[model samples]
Target: MPTHSVLIRDQALVTRLLQQYLHLLKTYPIITKSVTSAVLSALGNLLSQVLESKKKRKDGQSGKEVDVYGPLRFAVYGLVITGPLSHHFYHLLELLFPASAPFSLLKRLLLERLIFAPAFLLLFFAVMNTLEGKTHSDLQDKLKARYWPALKMNWKVWTPFQFININYVPVQYRVLFANLIALFWNAYLTSVRK
Candidate 1:
């Protein structure tokens, strides 16, 4: 919002902070990507509130303490799932093609689909089916019953929500988008619960 405009106007300060933040993440992805992303997001929010209060004191602003447990839980998800997966994928891809670098989401997704998705999907399904004691009939039944439902849900629900976020692809919006994704995952898991 205003922060980006402010940063754009005062490029020096924002640029310095952004570089520092990037360095922190690059250096300590295990910790920084998990905690720093959440922390920075929260602090960015708090700062916005503070500024709003200063601008319109009579409008009644608050400086309430946020419960950081939610962010911490999100951090755990980021660390265990997103961070390590990205790191491992980077290393594995580097070995496979030392000269090529992924520059865009399309490139990265294409690379992943070409190199990793098939192998990972096979291993993943094997482990899942084994653990769940899925017979051939059961697996077929699952594909028949669940696959279309999941595809429909992704297209009808998640895609619309994602498109809304995509409309405003600002840096602050990205953090909020991540938070919304976490919210969606929680809601989906709860829906799937028996």
Candidate 2:
């Protein structure tokens, strides 16, 4: 049971934190977004592991040991790949499809759904396969089995989000917005990889 004053204080603190974060974004956009993505990606992997463990327990099966490396790998990928790639991609999109351009929203959405999404998913699979220390043949097999399914799912889940993100969200905050969405997305990705 919290009092009204406590809630007010909490809100104020949150506001201050958000302001500081914005300042950081303005001052150090790439680094801030990268670190944020890394943290969220790690958390997503952890969330997936926790859910899997709970499911196993519910099924009266002994839970497997947590894979410490999984979250580490996700964090690295987010920091090195996703953050920078998204930062550049969104900037490029804005450059290519300025809002005043005819059918800008539709063009952006189509490009993202058709080109970026599939390529990004393929990159994700390749990178994760490499990170997992799988050989080239194994990577090829994974691509054959999982790539199409994941791309289909990605189209289903992300098309609407990308539409909103491209059309509505401010440019500076796009990566952060995507990162927040990727928190859940990463969890699903981790499960799919498993």
lDDT of each: 0.46, 0.91
Deviation (Å) of 90 in candidate 2: 0.3
**What's the TM-score of every candidate structure?**
0.37, 0.96
Best by lDDT: 2
For every model shown, the clashing-pair count is 0, 0
- The residue-by-residue lDDT of candidate 1 on 1-194, one tens digit each, is 56887877789887898888678756765565445444433344344444444656556655345444433443444445444454456555445544344444344444655444445333423433444556877656655555445444444554444434433343223333544454454334222311
Candidate 2 residue runs with Cα over 4 Å from true position: none
- The lDDT, on a scale of 0 to 1, for candidate 1 is 0.46
> Mind sharing the TM-score for model 1?
0.37
Best by TM-score: 2
